[model samples]
Target: MFLIVKSLMLVLMILMVLILVLNLCSMKTFYDKEKNSPFECGFDPKSNSRTPFSLQFFLIAIIFLIFDVEIALLLPIIKTYNMDNITLIITSNFFIIILLLGLIHEWNQGALNWLK
Candidate 1:
């Protein structure tokens, strides 16, 4: 315990010295207007960074999240279920039925169409 405390104190003292040195050095330098501005793509900086995005991108992302979560839920059950066992087979089938229902709903809503 004494060794651990001593080591921690040594580390803290080193960090404090480093911070003091950095602060002293930073005070000697002067910062300009551009230095404070948010850096852009290394290009000559432009003004309009907050342009509106497309709705289609959001729609596709949301659809992907929905299906991805469904699959994530499915995979664990698939791992647990044994095809040769009857009770597990029926439970897995019920899960599949619910997943199929969700798929049919998405299909009817034209969410499955990529070209639209």
Candidate 2:
């Protein structure tokens, strides 16, 4: 057991030394000029940065995130379905219903309205 532990420690030390050498070999001079420069994309920073964003864009983004997270929550339900679990199916439906009710409430409250 002591021999095995010592061998493992030796292997780890050699790997660490090799990693340090490789990192030093790959190091580049990152100066302030390179760091502060706008990226090489043809986009002009002055004009695009001042433009006002549309509310419709934000609303769609929020809805997309909400639904995206809902899909994340559904992954477990899918696993449960594969395992033939009825309780998980019912629980998943309950979560979907709650999301739908919240969406309806937001719609009624004009939170989801773009033209208001």
Task: Tell me the whole-model lDDT of each prediction, alpha carbons only.
Answer: 0.78, 0.78
- Ten consecutive residues with minimal summed lDDT in candidate 1? 40-49
**Cα deviation of 7 in candidate 2 (Å)?**
29
Task: Write the residue-wise lDDT of candidate 2 on 1-116 in tens digits.
Answer: 99999999999999999999998997566676765668734545656675666778677688879878987887777765654567767888899898899789878877677686
lDDT computed for candidate 2: 0.78
lDDT of 1 by residue, 54-111 (tens): 5666677887898789879877885776666777778878878988898898789887
**How does each model score on TM-score?**
0.51, 0.49
Candidate 2 residues lying further than 4 Å off, grouped into runs, are 1-44, 80-84
Q: How many collisions per candidate?
A: 0, 0
